[model samples]
Target: MADLDPTATFKEFDADGDGYITREEFTAAMKARGEEVTPAELDSIFRVADGRDGDADGRISQAEFLVAWDR
Candidate 1:
């Protein structure tokens, strides 16, 4: 399988062009991608992604996201 481009994925989720993916952005991105997630489930998903590598800043920085992708 071809590799997933973490930067591209991150860019897709960083809707605001602010170099960070907020919870709102993440939720919107997921919904736009046709992900069916309830509010609680979305929160959990964001929490896990934001929590990866111990980054709990409430927003996802590209660095954090890249590290989470192990790239």
Candidate 2:
């Protein structure tokens, strides 16, 4: 598989163009990209992503996304 561009991937998942991704947006994007995640796994993903949510909001900002992507 080709290397994925983190910025591009993050933007695509930010469906609302608000510069942040909610749980719903993340799930939809992952599913559309052919990823099948269980509810427990999804929760874990959210936890990791939201850990970078500086404002404690339920959304992942571009910066946070980049950090997660790099990891």
Candidate 3:
């Protein structure tokens, strides 16, 4: 797959314009992209994203989202 633009993708997923992607926003984004993420998969994604969360907030920041996307 072609590399996605992190900034653009991040903005799109940040539905609330809060500069962070909550789990709900992430799930909605995934669904919009036709990705049916299972609960297990969502948990895994959150775990990975949280691991990279510098501020320890539950939501994923742009930097954290970019890191996960690059991976």
Among all candidates shown, the one with the greatest TM-score: 3
In model 2, the runs with Cα more than 4 Å from the true position are: 1-3
Please give the clash total of every predicted structure, in order.
Answer: 0, 0, 0
Off by over 4 Å in 1: 1-3, 38-56
Candidate 1's residue-wise lDDT over 1-71, tens digit each?
Answer: 02388889988889878999887887788788877557787677568767774767777788877876773
**Model 2 global lDDT (CA atoms, 0 to 1):** 0.80
Cα lDDT of model 3 by residue, 1-71, tens digit: 13368888888889999999888998898888877778888778777777875455678888887777777
Predicted structure 2, TM vs. truth: 0.80
Clashing pairs in 3: none
Q: Estimate each model's TM-score.
A: 0.68, 0.80, 0.82
Reference-based lDDT, residue 50, model 2: 70
Off by over 4 Å in 3: 1-3
Worst 10 residues of 1 by lDDT: 45-54
**lDDT of candidate 2 over 1-71, digit per residue (tens):** 12389888888989999998888898898788788768787688677777766466778888988887777
